[model samples]
Target: MFFRSSKINEFRLWGLLFTLAGMGLMILGTSGIVFWGQAGKIFAGIFMVIGMIAMLISVGVYFWAGMMSTSATMLTCPECSRQTKMLGKTDRCMYCKTILTLDPGQATQHPADTTQT
Candidate 1:
């Protein structure tokens, strides 16, 4: 059946937060050098590296989500007759609470493949 869009949205939100946090850390690290001397410079360098890595990972995840979103197929919910996109083998209608499945065999065979059941 349908799963909550909140999970994917949450991941995207967290990725954004990480990206912003990384940028802020990088800036703070660079700015510290003017007043803090060698120690500040070293700390700033460390922050910069960590921040860059975090931002890179976030960017990669965002890109992946984008690709998945694009590949998701749009369908009408039989339960509510509302339209929504299906990701993977199963997904829920955004407007309806009905559990939708893309694969009929999954519902009959696995029964527990919630994605398709």
Candidate 2:
């Protein structure tokens, strides 16, 4: 719940962060002209280029997430009674954060189990 989310959501979160960061960088680049007059253009260009790269990376991440999501297992969360997507053999409920798994062996393992060892 605190730091857990569906794989798809996690990817989306990263994409959102990248997008925000890129936008912020671009804004900062534009603002350089106001702060440094003519010399700011060089800094502005460099920042803008880096920002574009970040945005491109974000797009790639989003695309990868979308492709992965299409093949991910969809299940009804017992705890939340909501449909959620799960990646790999185990994942937590996106809404309720209840541990979920398709394998019987993994199903018995919980967050507490990891903390003990």
Candidate 3:
């Protein structure tokens, strides 16, 4: 669960970083020709293409994250007693640090005991 949350947070951060970088590149590319010479134009074209690709990839990542978020199961944390969501074979309560596992045979398993309350 800790790993999953970390991964999700990392993905979110990367997506944001890529988005900002792409926007900056786009602005630089468009302004370069006005400030510099023909060399600027060449660099601008290259930067624009790379920036557009980065932006597109970020959009794809956002969509993928949305899908995963929807598929995750909701639960209440036993430790924190707060509503949270879980995903995959193992997960953590979003509101608490409790390690949650859906597998019944595992020693660390927490039952899918709670419904909405």
Residues 39-93 of candidate 1: C-alpha lDDT, one tens digit per residue: 7989899989999998998998788877777777888888778777777776656
Model 2, residue 11: distance off in Å is 0.7
Q: Write the per-residue lDDT of candidate 3 for residues 1-117, one digit (tens) a residue.
A: 224453354456678878998999989898888888887899899889989998988888777767777777777777888877676766666655577766777646555867888
Against the unseen true structure, what C-alpha lDDT does each candidate score? Answer: 0.75, 0.88, 0.74
lDDT for residue 52 in candidate 3, whole number 0-100: 97
- Clashes in model 2: which pairs? none
Badly placed stretches (over 4 Å) of model 3 are 1-8, 28-31, 107-117
Candidate 3 at 56: error in angstroms?
0.6
How does model 3 score by TM-score?
Answer: 0.71
Quick one: best TM-score, which candidate? 2
User: Model 2, 1-117: lDDT tens per residue?
Assistant: 335877778888889999999999999999998899999999899999999999999999999999999999999998889999899988888788888899877667544554553
| lDDT value, candidate 3, whole model | 0.74
Worst 10 residues of 1 by lDDT: 1-10
Worst 10 residues of 3 by lDDT: 1-10
What is the Cα root-mean-square deviation between model 3 and the actual structure?
5.8
Q: Candidate 2, overall lDDT?
A: 0.88
TM-score of each: 0.62, 0.87, 0.71
Full-model lDDT, candidate 1: 0.75
Residue pairs with backbone overlap in model 1: 1-99, 2-92, 2-99
Runs in model 1 deviating more than 4 A are 1-3, 6-8, 31-35, 77-82, 92-99, 103-117
